[model samples]
Target: MKLLLAGIVLILIIMWKPMPSGAGDMWRAYSDMREANWKNSDKYFHARGNSDAASRGAGGRWAAEVISNAREWVQERTGHGAEDSAADQKANEHGRNGGDPNDYRLLGLPEKY
Candidate 1:
């Protein structure tokens, strides 16, 4: 009975993913940010990544939350300013909650983004 319950729980977790591409989405956003190298655009990328992943469903939202929190926690200790980290977290939350990432995007950004 215990084994069966565990198996059922595992199955539920597996079934939660509409697709297993959330992490990749997050990574792509990071890569794009690096490529863009646009000043003051980091918050936009953070929101975009979380929003992109969250739109995929619960699994994606979970991945985005985990990755965003972990990244910010690391950054807080790695010489990044407190204000910047706080703003980043705010952007991340905004996206995860279905807020439009474009709200954070800067004008004049190229269409390829």
Candidate 2:
């Protein structure tokens, strides 16, 4: 009976959940969010050349949503308001000027008076 009780206690201790290490988990979460945000931002800027405002808006909105989500996730996970700094840098670096003429700027075709 004592042996059985000892085994049970050991099992219980093994199965118990360990407490979260705040900073370590938070850093991991921040890294994950940064990756996701970079992907979504790339997709949006890649498709931004479309003349359709609706499509552009949709892409923009999706990018914004993902970026915002990543920002909030990082902030909550890290307990700091980093606000998607990595993603912003990625957008500014690779996504902004890598595309065609129409993609670099927001100006559409000239209006027909």
Candidate 3:
């Protein structure tokens, strides 16, 4: 009778022991979720970095264009710019006609004639 009772207790202990299928599934699911979240975060940060670099390049190009336009506008308003452009054109034409390669007059320098 005592042996039978001990056998029943051992059987109950074996039945109540934790199983791998129960807690293991929960742990695996949690690990998969963590891995997926990490991958999503990495992709988001990579895309953000690419977008930031592209925007910085575009902004730099836009700033350069604005500065160029401003300088051209100021040169036009000063009055000397137009005259120099016209003189440069005329000097280029004269140099072409005379077949002169070294024409200092194209530089808008004062001529001593």
Candidate 4:
């Protein structure tokens, strides 16, 4: 099946390019978001995490894609709204495509972020 093939390919990619710094990039983004806890900033953090990881190179990009997609998939199954998940996915893709994470940054978010 196509889905099975895709899953196998995905597994191979993960094995081939286990992210090093990219994982840390994603983690730092998450930690920053939690520390900031600024209002209306979820999307920004999502973008930031993806962007930071993606900037690391191909492996990082793949890791970001896997992580983001997995997160969204989990969220959608756990009572999260489809619309919000879609928006989050859009932000993830935007960052993966090299869009500035700051574009999603809040107007007055703490400079520490």
Candidate 5:
């Protein structure tokens, strides 16, 4: 009877043990902040206009790279890369054309974009 009671206690302890936290719930947030810094750095450079088209293009390219990294982070966390790509494409297109006239559609873009 004592053995049976001990076995039950062990089983309860095993069941109650905590599961390990996922990396998506932790490290990915730091990765995202790094990526944002890269993109914002590009915008800051472009605003200055100290360089010609080629250098500005390079900055834009870096921004694209940071965006890609952010997308990968999102994919790892949610398993939904296609959705992020579609949303990103829409945002880029809007920026290229100087944004939508309608305020509702314009809600998604950041104030500077």
Candidate 6:
């Protein structure tokens, strides 16, 4: 009886769906890239002694472009592209709404009654 109970408990634990961590990790990586890009752009602009409003605007745009490129590269390398991010967001939202974290509906499937 104890062995059977233990088996059931283990199964239940295995079946439990935990919150996804990929989105958080992706966000952290993106933020890091953005910061690095911004710092590099700032240094480049400052080195050229071009701290005018136009220079600042150009630097910001360059930094954003670099971050976007880096994000796409990371996603392609990791096989977790924008679609995965969207699914993760949906699952996170569904979990916050009291739905199961692993629910199929979170993947945009029609819910079966």
> What is candidate 5's lDDT per residue for 12-88, written digit by digit as tens?
55433321111222233234334445432332222211111112233333343344446556765887667655654
Q: Candidate 4: how large is its RMSD? A: 5.1
- Residue 111 in candidate 3 has what lDDT? 33
Q: TM-score for candidate 4, please give it.
A: 0.83
Clashing pairs in 5: none
* Per-residue accuracy of model 6 over 2-95 as CA lDDT, tens digit each: 9999998875554332212323333443444355454323222221111111123333323333333454468668887676545434433343
Model 5 ranges with Cα > 4 A deviation = 1-56, 69-73, 96-113
Q: Ten-residue segment with the worst summed lDDT in candidate 2?
A: 46-55
Ten-residue region with minimum lDDT total, candidate 6: 45-54
lDDT of 4 at 40: 81
lDDT per prediction?
0.88, 0.38, 0.37, 0.88, 0.38, 0.37
What is the descending TM-score order? 1, 4, 5, 6, 3, 2
lDDT tens string, model 3, 28-72? 333443544543232222222222222333332233233334544
Specify the poorest-scoring 10-residue window by lDDT in model 3.
Answer: 43-52
State, as a TM-score between 0 and 1, how close model 1 is to the true structure.
0.86
Model 4 Cα lDDT, one tens digit per residue, 50-95: 9988987788888899989999999999999999999999999989
> RMSD of candidate 6 to the true fold?
21.3
Error of 4 at 76 (Å): 0.5
Best by TM-score: 1
TM-score of each: 0.86, 0.23, 0.24, 0.83, 0.26, 0.25
Ranking 5 against 6 by lDDT, winner:
5
Cα-based RMSD of the predictions, in order? Answer: 2.4, 17.3, 35.0, 5.1, 18.7, 21.3
Candidate closer to the true structure by lDDT (higher is better), 2 or 3: 2
C-alpha RMSD of candidate 1: 2.4
Clashes per candidate, residues 3 or more apart or on different chains: 0, 0, 0, 0, 0, 0
Tens digits of per-residue lDDT for model 1, 5-40: 999898668746733577778899999999998889
